[model samples]
Target: MTTILHIDSSARPGRSGEQAHGSHTRRLTARFIERYRQFDSRTEVIYRDVGAVPPSPVTGGWVHAAFTPPAAREPWMVEALAQSDALVDEVLAADIIVAGVPMYNFGPPAQFKAWLDNIVRVGRTFGFDRSRAGEPYWPLLADAGKQLVILSSRGDYGYGPGQRLEGINHVEGSVRSVFRYLGVTHAYDAAVEYDEFGDERLLRSLADAESATDRIAQVIASVRTRRHAA
Candidate 1:
């Protein structure tokens, strides 16, 4: 069975129109999940709400403990890395990952940053190889054969290619960079823009995003079906 890791980083709940508190990205992700389930009932989903219960930031203690060999680490060191280990395990076990992230202040929220810090361990997601001449850093999670789908919500428009705010849009860029470092090259993005200007523009953007997300779900389902048959 295909295992999907669904992560929501919006500080809201429920689908759109259910409550005014719900974020656009959360509603998009919900629609994606609903359509995905309809395509494949046997798929397994593991959900994590980082915005509601953010992971602890990586501190000095965490850095030291993560670098230390597991066999030589003290009890406290082991405890410090427990969450990181678990998060890494979840990623390693998943075939697909769906993430909901909202653009806040031109970037992702601190809650999403904390979750990224926990999962990107030195010896876990990536590694350093001094054996090379100059470029020694290599990704351990590379070739893990996984796909990532990102759902982003932005208050303003013109964040796409050749747009007015393209250069300043950090939400999609940051997410792609981190996942690329972890060896995930096949990543897709679906975004809802003009949220602050809630009207016909917002409705049109949401519709476009929803269509993109549905297409992605269909593609993933087809891929999983082929993999299962093989």
Candidate 2:
């Protein structure tokens, strides 16, 4: 069975047309998962709603706890890292991670950022050794086969690679960088733009994004099925 870690980070509780000022990213991720499941029946989805209940922001205590060796950590440190440990376990247990993150300002919502902070822990998701000849930091999960699919939304246009506003667009770039560091080497993204202007352009963009999501799901399902059979 394929295990998918489904994460929704949009503050909006519902999908567009389903709720007032609903999240476009939520709609895209829902469609992506639904379509993906049609291709494979034996699938397990672990849902996490960071929007409604976000992970606690990393504090000095969290830092100390994450950096300390597991066996050496004190009781307080262990308590501090409990949530992060759980989050990392969920990521490690999944073969695929599908996240719905919306652009706030130029980057992801603070809620999603907190979730990233929780999971990207040293000695957990990454490794550090002072007695190394080369670089000491390495991704621990690099050998683990995992894929990341990000569905995002934006209010403005021109955020694609080489686009006019690409330099300022940190939404997908930030998430991809974080996941890449966590050893999610394979990644896919599909987004909807022109959200502020809910006009014909928005409608067209949403439609296009929906099609893109469907195609991505099909492609991923094919590759996963082949791998499973192999």
| Candidate 2 TM-score to native | 0.98
For each candidate, what is the lDDT?
A: 0.89, 0.92
Pairs with steric clashes in candidate 2: none
Which stretches of model 1 miss by more than 4 angstroms?
131-134
The residue-level lDDT of candidate 1 at 154 comes to 91
How good is model 1 by TM-score? 0.95
Best by lDDT: 2
> In candidate 2, residue 49 scores what lDDT?
94
Worst 10-residue stretch by lDDT in candidate 1?
Answer: 12-21
Give candidate 2's error at residue 50 in angstroms.
0.4
- Candidate 2 lDDT tens digits, 97-177: 999999899999999999999999987898889898899888988988899999999999989999999999898889999
For model 2, state the Cα shift of residue 226 in Å: 1.2
Q: Global lDDT for candidate 2?
A: 0.92
